[model samples]
Target: MTEIYYVEDDGDIGEAVKEYFESRTFKVTLYRTAEAAKESLRKQLPDLVLLDWNLPDEEGSLLCQWIRSRWKELPLMFLTVRNDTKDIVKGFQNGADDYVEKPFELEVLYSRICALLRRAGNPSGQKVISCGTLTINKEKMMVFCDGQEVSVSRLEYQLLLILMEHKGITVTRQSLLELIWDQNGNFVNDNTLTVAMRRLRQKLNQPSCIKTIRSFGYRMEDEI
Candidate 1:
């Protein structure tokens, strides 16, 4: 599961955001002040951080700078009421991956958070997904298992990447069919998915990372 640190002084707003994100399966830690957030961050780093422009203890901009100074690659987003152009620019300058004004919709925030996480996972202009010993390099169009190249067909590779990208999450059969059908530009039937999965498992040497959920779909587990 992905973890998020949200720093906001407003209790109502903080709980609302935390509640909404938690319902989506994301573990969120809500901090009432910048000082409290800093204390918690020192112990455990989250996948992403959501900061408000104004805080009771310290300026959120300064805290953002503090976080970037340490975890330069960590994704940071600003969810605040500061909608001024200058404030927006300052947030970006302070190393925020995204900035969304207050009075926002949850759906938009969720999409932006997903986008930032995707970028954070695959950096340096290369698209890659890693689950345990298996690696899928989308940029170079290659797949490697246990440091050795694995030969996979186009449909097989596409199917593997989709599952790997959503690491630790179950990808339903219907969703897989739709994705592969559209991306591969070929009609994919239900049996095709089952056969491809079996072949993929064998080629990967029956890796335990990919789990078969009976009567549902498959989930890629990153923990080997």
Candidate 2:
């Protein structure tokens, strides 16, 4: 299923869009603010984002810039009431794949979304994620380090994938738990994360790649 992150402050519009997408079998997560949406994006990259120009907390253009800096190829579309020519140009300038004005037909919006997804190709997780000598193949759920395949448990692979997906960014412990454990109904303690990190690093034989952020969490450095 294609995952979509929709950010819109208007409750009615957000709900309508969410329902419409969900009805079509697309997994949709709706956020009312750019901050919440950004937090989610940090943990996992959705297939596409349907952003609003006027978010409650920050301008959608700012969010666009932030997302482009981190996930350059992730598709983004502005679903807003701002239909001015400058606004449309600004949306593209900030890395938007498409722009749809408010009061749009659901059918038209769906078509645009399909076109954007087609242009963006497949979701990131379906492709190999690599940094330096480490490579992760999500299709086969395998990791290779320094040209040798490394054995990793399911949880370890999940942890590594998340870190690699958000390389160079500090991934908080809370976010890691929520993304890797809570979803699977696994009751993992903080120590489990530590253990997993230790084992993953040892297996990969690159201890310096994953750095402990003291009280914060962990960050996967781009260069190992």
Candidate 3:
């Protein structure tokens, strides 16, 4: 199932959106405060996050920044009353993938959500991805090297999936940070990528599976 973490302070609005999304077969977890939402994010990364501009404890923008710093690939959208052009721009700057004005049509919201998921390459549930000797089962969130099951962190799995999706192409460091880390490459230290790559390679037991394109980025070979 597609999981959504929705943060809204208003009880009526939160309940209504949660109920509607649940009806559409989405697993919705609603939070009335930014702190609670942040806590949930740390436990498990959701497919998408629907955030309100104003939370009872903190501004949604702050929460967005925190999330981006951690789960960079997670899709986030703003569903709030802040329709001002400045506010929209700020939302995007803060890390929102989409912004919707208040009193939105449920159909429109659903469409936007689907579009975002599609763009993120998670259009549906239970996807199996394979590259070289590695296989990833999305629903199970598990990885296998050859026929042996391998344990990997959530970030490692996300990084591997991105590389596998674009196998053979040198994914630039900046691109990796934007797509995998949700941070500007300039702001994040390159060592972060290095450590993650090292761990992933070790877990897969195939160091040659991922190649560093010296001064550029990394590439996943078609065969290990």
Candidate 4:
């Protein structure tokens, strides 16, 4: 589920692109102004961005610079009517991974997007998984709750990743052990998993978005 933030002022173009992207299995978030996109970026970092020049609220180049400064690995592309050589050059200089002119073919745009993501080594981009106040950044393997970093052991982090990746689903105890310890070549007894889970809960501010299933496994949900 590759998440894309598309900032465009034109209603027609924005909706058309959103529909096309969704049909291709991409989760698209449309922003009519650069300010709106900026605000969303503060909370959720998408895998990529489709920007339009001459945005209603701000210059798209400024937005590109802003995103690049904060998230160097985030893929960015400009889809705009600004086809002049100067504009395209400026776009790349401002941190655009790719750029496409207006009246572009949707298929070609999609291809370019795929290429950008492939170059970044994210063929199947992941959505920024969030549960309640907790956020998981898979690329960095970092977790944050209430805007503060939640430090955890390697095994705990792996456990959190699996649960957050499958939010709302009960992942069984055996599966957790297999995936977290066995698969990682750090085999441990079942009791160790219980201890780690408890420490993780305490460290993440207790009742930290993880719920136990008594005889089953654990699930991540909005309610703690």
lDDT of 3 by residue, 103-194 (tens): 98888999999999999787223465556556666766777665457888767887888887787799998788778656223344578877
What is the lDDT, from 0 to 100, of the residue 182 in candidate 3? 62
3 or 4, which is superior by TM-score? Answer: 4
lDDT digits (tens) for residues 9-65 of candidate 2:
999998988899899998889999998887666555678899999987899998997
Model 1 bad stretches (over 4 Å): 122-224
TM-score of each: 0.55, 0.62, 0.58, 0.62
- Candidate 2 residues lying further than 4 Å off, grouped into runs, are 128-224
Residue pairs in clash, model 2:
none
Candidate 3 off by > 4 Å: 123-224
Cα lDDT for residue 81, model 1? 93
Residue 82, model 1: Cα distance from true site in angstroms: 0.6
Question: 1-224 in candidate 1: lDDT tens per residue?
Answer: 78888999999988988899999999889998988887665444577899998998898999998877755556899999999999999999998989999999998999999999998883312354566667665767887776568999898999898998787789999999999999978899999999999999899999888998888899987542
How high is the lDDT of residue 128 in model 3?
Answer: 52
